[model samples]
Target: MMKKLENFAIQDFQNDLINWYRNEKRDLPWRKNQDPYKIWVSEVMLQQTRVDTVIPYFNEFTTKFPTIQALANADEEEVLKAWEGLGYYSRVRNLHSAVKEVNECYGGIVPNDPNEISKLKGVGPYTKGAILSIAYNIPEPAVDGNVMRVMSRILSIWDDIAKVKTRNLFEEIIREIISQEYPSDFNQALMELGAIICTPTSPSCLLCPVREHCAAFHEGVQTELPVKSKKKKPVPLQMAAAVLYDENGQLYIHKRPPTGLLANLWEFPNCELKQELNKTHTEQLALFLKEEYDIEAALQPLIGTIQHIFSHRIWNLSIYFGEIKSMESEKLVQVDEETIKQYAFPVSHQKIYKMYKGEI
Candidate 1:
């Protein structure tokens, strides 16, 4: 067990960290202002996503929905469309829901009170702490993966970062040592340090601003301090997706169910392959069209396969082109290419469309 930093050492650590951050922090769009709405969106978008990838998306999203009211008033489909290609549809969905709640309940203001803010949809501990500390300048702990990695090395904590109890302990440690005078800068500095210097492999300890204060460095075990267990492999799913068009050459698509994985996004009608030993995937898709939508179809040759990996599942999509021989159900809509672009489809199906058009 490592001893806690003494008062003087804590002061030195805070000063060094905040000063380095003020001088070296990346000029991200969200850093331009402390608007809680923008901070909230940026933080939500940044979850499990890279900084560079998020830059253009963040700029475009904020520009489209400039304020909480703007986002809350916008159609859910529109919001989802703006968030297309970002993947993780649930993040935006929850953000949209919470934005509406904020607009209705809080008069378009993001609550500064921890308890009040925590009540909002999808605002977890890290997000709650981040908004409070960074947006409101409250001295709360904002411990994400990066912060946890940095804290583990700095305090020589050997706890498995994968566990929630370990994360709680780190949060407690941050509360104890975080700079009250500059809580926003303090939290951002920690995140920035982990991102640039205290990386997952071959950390740049020599250039680290608080190198002298790092417990793992002093103990010569910086690389081994943050112990994380390996993640389980994503479960594989074999799917057959059909791109069916009517005689008018309008493509058929449907919206996903309201509340589940990939909820409310549009997609080429697809399903998980229950692989009957006797039938081909295309034959199965034809049966699905007949059963689900009551459509008789002339299934054509396989277009191709598209592979998409989610955090918990990998979809191997078998794409097939089909024509609607007859139709009865009103569950699907047929739209021309120009009209189809208005709807938001999952990344996998988007690829399927591009492949159908030979755009790849």
Candidate 2:
């Protein structure tokens, strides 16, 4: 059986957390109203992103696509452009698809039923709980990493947080302790506490509003409690990219396949460096261009290298300038800088553009 707080203790924890959140919560744009669409967008954008970093992007995205109908009606390229630098392109794509589903099936009203909301693309457990509790004041648990950390310290949960089972346990615990009267504030309070006070390292125990009720703080092991397994380091990859320009000075770019990592994003023609092929990076670029696009190029020297880190991989791209010698495939598009801006390129390719311009 899971450990349970006494009734009084649970009430005290809820009141302290909600009261502190009311007074101490940052004035974020998402918190300005309980619009489920805005909250959903903010939640999606905030995943694996810092609040400060997401603020401007959130503002731009909401301003550009203000409602579920608007976002649902937007072209995929336009949505990707709005989410260009946010990385994790799949999130926006999934959100875009899900929003369209809601628009069509639910008449643009965000589903308040957990079962219905959970069925939406990319609306996982954490996001489901967040929307239900915060937007609808439903007493569901939003057990994200921040909430897990806060709860682990609050109730002294020592389970490995990286495990799905532990996350489920925290969800159960929060369900038992969440404030029904102020479910929205209660859920936000746990996340806020984790963000500002009960941090992963050297948590601000002295400043915690619910410090008196924190089991880990009383035990003097707040930092040691919320155990999580270390993730494997990102695998390093060596890649060769061709910034091929046609006679008109228009750069050549292509869209990635419609699925998988960086899907549908534009990029300068690029390929992984094959060590077994015994070919230099430039030679590999030439072969890739010829084989993939049926075009040959006079590959030039490296302008510079660009490195972009993903969750599980690191791309070390060696960029080379080239002039298109011949063209056959109808897939590639040649565009000047201004025209290129209309298409959404991944950050790595964006850096290639800057290198092409001698800006970086």
TM-score of each: 0.97, 0.97
lDDT of 1 by residue, 1-360 (tens): 225545337888899999999899999999999999999999999999999999999999999999998999999888999999887789999999999999999999999999999999889999999999999999999999999999899888888999999999988889888998899999999999999999999999999999998889999999896999999999999999998887888898999998888989999988888765578887788888889999888888887889999889999999988888999999998889888878899888889999889897
lDDT of 1 at 336: 94
Candidate 2 has what TM-score? 0.97
Note the residue pairs that clash in candidate 1. Answer: none
Best by TM-score: 2
The residue-by-residue lDDT of candidate 2 on 1-360, one tens digit each, is 344565338877888889999999999999999999999999999888999989999999999999999999999989999999888889999999999999999999999999999999999999999999999999999999999898888777778999999999988888888898999999999999899988889999999999998888889999797899999999999999988888889888899999988999999888999789988888888888889999988888887888999889999999999899899997898888688888888888889889988899
